[model samples]
Target: MIALLSAPSNLGLRPPQRGSVPGVSKAPEALREAGLFRRLLDDGATDAGVVLAGRYIDDDDARAPGHVRNEEALVDHARRLADRLTSILDAGDAPLVIGGDCSLLLGIGVALARRGGAGLVHVDGHTDFRHPGNSDECASVAGEDLAAATGLHWPAIADIDGLAPYFAPQRAVHIGHRDDDEELEEVRGIIGLVVSAADAAVAASDDLAASVVETAGTGYWLQIDVDVLDPEVMPAVDSPDPGGLGVPELTELLRRLAPRAIGASVTVFDPDLDPDGRFARLLADVVVDALRTLGTAV
Candidate 1:
């Protein structure tokens, strides 16, 4: 069965400069209020409850290494989160970890590493491979998740529990990234296949899913950052890049991808941006439908 795991974290987002709202931390509750868990339960899924971790504590250190915000809290949270995922997997349930932000990828990576490594299917609008040094004032850990997961960044974040490069470059496939020139250049230096948003637009969904599965080998972890969807449909993310996949396109891709995944995560849906709660409901439906496609639900 698939278990819904809430990871309510906002540590990865940069602190509000002033008078800015903080709401990603509340995604888990927001999604539940929108009946994500109930819908899954109606479809025959299990509720794993939430994984408690350190609360979001914004960092004030501008000179921190790699300019990574909330370094200490992030590290601690990753450790605890990894432990929780490990427990769920050990119990033989597929975990559907929700929200916090992309930085929670570190914990997922660590858990997979403990199980002798796994492939990663990264679906996002941005590549999320930016090295900390390359980022500006924001220096959000959410933006650097994929990079850190692949060991392209600091050891503390990348090498958690001495498992650096959680998934080898050859074992990962990054899809749907629409990044700028410099970011694309950096991504190119990485040792994995990057399928741009444009490429995904033209490629057949089955072919793309097959290619990703083949690349990831036997088992893989799927990460669906909602920003990967078009801003028109998913405007609840922290950074909504333009020109992303439509809801139907993303749903088709998930149907093709989720079966091969051992576990998966959904991130970056900010309830504050979705004041009317419409986007939250839409996202919940998409995810539930994907889980059903995975055969984890009735």
Candidate 2:
């Protein structure tokens, strides 16, 4: 069975404007309104309820390195999220986590680390690899989550409960980042498999599935940042670079890849940019269609 968990956290992102909280926090409710949950429930997925987030403390021109915004609150929320995920796993249900932003990876990492580890398949338009070592603008956890998850960031968020390196670098596969990504070269050296969006869009789904499956061992966690969709198709993300996958291509890849993963998280879709709820409905359709075959293996 699939268990849908809503993690409405915007704490990971910088503010769209000064003094304003990011609206990605509304993503779960937006997706729900678009019938994502209803369709999943009809298809045998269970509503695992929500993991509420701490209030987002905006980072307005604050380039304070190593000073992650909402440090205490974000840590607390992650720990609490871990507790909830633990229960969902205990029930033997595959988790479909809907996110407010990518920072929820911290919590997911905590849960997976406690579960004896799993491979990570990161599908994003950007690497999310900004760390103190590479950049001074490391305040947004959403953009730096991969670094935090792989234990390349500060000890505070990266080493929660002393479980640093939530997913081993050698067991991780990163797909869909653009070739021009600033962190591409560096991430490639650290991550086991790194595929650019251009390459991933052209590669056979079967081949992509084999790479992730072989590296994932017995179980794996799939994480999707919706910006992987071309801005023409999905512009609701915090950062929408050009040259991304089309909806059909993304849906095909997910169909081939998501089924074998133990759980998945969909992140960075902001309903504020989707005022008419068009993109939300479209994303919902794509997700519901692709994940309906959740437990089927490659």
lDDT of all the models against the reference?
0.81, 0.89
lDDT string for model 2 (1-298, tens) is 8899999999998888888888898999999999999999998889999999877776555546567988878999999999998998888788899998999999999999998888999999999999999997788899999989999999999999999999999888898898889998999899988988899889999998888788766468889999999999999999999999999889999888877888899999999999999999999999987777664552
Best by TM-score: 2
lDDT tens per residue, model 1, 23-123: 78889999999999899888777888786557655556444645476777788888888888899888878888988788899889999998899999888
Provide the TM-score for each candidate, comma-separated.
0.93, 0.97
Model 2 spans > 4 angstroms off: 59-65, 296-298
Q: Number of the top candidate by lDDT?
A: 2
* TM-score of candidate 2 relative to the true fold: 0.97
Worst lDDT 10-window in candidate 2: 57-66
Clashes of each: 0, 0
lDDT (Cα, 0-100) at 138 in candidate 1:
37
Candidate 1 — which residues are off by over 4 angstroms? 19-21, 61-63, 132-138, 179-181, 295-298
